[model samples]
Target: MELRQLSHFLAVARRRSFTLAAHDVNVVQSSLSASIRQLERELGATLFDRTTRRVELSPAGRALLPIARHILADARAAKAEISAVQGLLRGQVALGTIQMLTWIDLPEVLARFTKAYPGVEISLLEAPVDEMIEALRSGELDLAYLACGVDELPAALTVIDSDTEPLAVAAGPDHPLAGQPGVRLADLEAEPFVEFQAGTGLQTVVDRLCHDAGLKRRIVLRTTQLELLASLVRHGLGLAVLPVGVAHQAGLTAVPIIGNTADRTVALVTRAGHDSNPAVRALLDLLRPDPAG
Candidate 1:
């Protein structure tokens, strides 16, 4: 069918609500519904099931999602290449990022980039490192800021810029280990830990470090929110291993780990060949401005 129909279908599929999708696409609900209906009529398959309160994608919708995404991405890429040849930058640049960033000033950078390239549309997604890597590989994302360990980067992804921070054991002021200058990784084996959710970058780093050090922690609470994790540790639910900056911000005592160099690396990564997209390149220039200039 038409490209607009595919776009409408995707909006509904993503939002799971005609109302929300309509608002997202800046169209009336009736218009969005008509587009979907027209698309279904042409395809000869129902794209969504609207029997219940929550709208769910039908089997046909599920089958079309990836193909639709690929088509749109290709279309956007073609448009961007054409615009670049005409000495203009236009189209979409989708960037993914891990939730925590102690170093980057992303909002400020985005403000500048959007002001500079008003023609380009930007989408920012917060996800775990692994998921972002997959998104970059699948053409869903042009760039991702992720926490990766040394030499553990995905095969098809390459880095544009990177920063590293040391990890520390975070303990409340009242904890017995609070005053320690350097706590060994083994010391945390018997401690109850307040940990990040499994998919998070910090959680992944902490798990690998513990696994290598032959230490098993008794995780008392797991949370996706950084503030919640900090609160859990502060209220003595458990100790946590976090970046020094995060520990300091949360007002926890950060004790360095003896003989451990499990630093967290935040890298701006992209799929190997996808860096050629003009919109993505413009954002990259903002992300790492030339020092010589």
Candidate 2:
């Protein structure tokens, strides 16, 4: 029934390991277990099914997960609101982002936010788009940076800011297609490609472009590291689709696609109706583009 019990229960439900959840919440396993037991007793429902090898959420736990998240979010928002009334922001803001940090100018935004509200703590987590969206939905992240086409987003999410940029086909200087003008997606049908892993937003964009072009890319390597993917392309291992700035910085020859088949739209996203944290709001304001620019 207590907020602390709900907090412990949510950690356990997310991690599915009592020890891991205990570590996450900075508490001992026994204390966390006792809290979950107390919560379950108060609710008159079994929340987890525990075994020697694994722990799984019971039906009741699944049902309570979203409710617990909402309660925690509201509590945090209330605390932040109270703190803001004292002319100071003091709370933790967890932000999620993809790998393209430099392009987003996130460090600059962070610098401004920390300088303005030194008491507010900030944590940055990096994950793929799908994972980041899930974190936002689950209340693990107050804000997230994602990449999409900028047309429509999921019902549970809202875009704070979006910037659309053209995607470029990157190739080694010595490659046959290097410096080629007007390179269409189908032009690289037989070319090997080095791309991000399946779950990443960049990979999704590449897949969609190839699918629309009626071609399946010959992916020779799949990796999570953007620098490594660029390195592979630089070494003539395979071609890749990348943001124009990133491709040029990696010293790869970047050519624009002939059609509007591939473009990168980076968006700052948050849960649709959960924007009450003062720290989160401050960061979002700093990230917003200047009207004069």
In TM-score terms, which candidate is top?
1
In the predicted model 1, the residue pairs found to clash are none
Error of 2 at 153 (Å): 1.6
lDDT, residue 274, candidate 1: 67
The residue-by-residue lDDT of candidate 2 on 1-293, one tens digit each, is 88889878877876678987787678899999999998989999999999998999999999998899888877766776776675554676888888854455788789888898898888776766766777788777888888765565678888888887778889988988885786888767789988887777777887888788877789889887888988899899999888788788788998888865578788888886445666777787787788788
lDDT of 1 at 29: 100
TM-score of each: 0.77, 0.75
Weakest 10 consecutive residues, lDDT, candidate 2?
80-89
Index of the highest-lDDT prediction: 1
Report the lDDT tens digits of candidate 1 across residue range 1-293. Answer: 88788878877876678987787678999999999999999999999999759999999999998888788767767776776775445667888877678776788999998998888788776766766666677676888888886377877888877889999999888998888889889867788998887777778889999888878999878887888988888888899999998899899999898877768888888887665677777788888745785
Which residue runs does candidate 2 get wrong by more than 4 Å?
A: 1-71, 101-103, 272-275
Worst 10 residues of 1 by lDDT: 82-91
lDDT of each: 0.82, 0.80
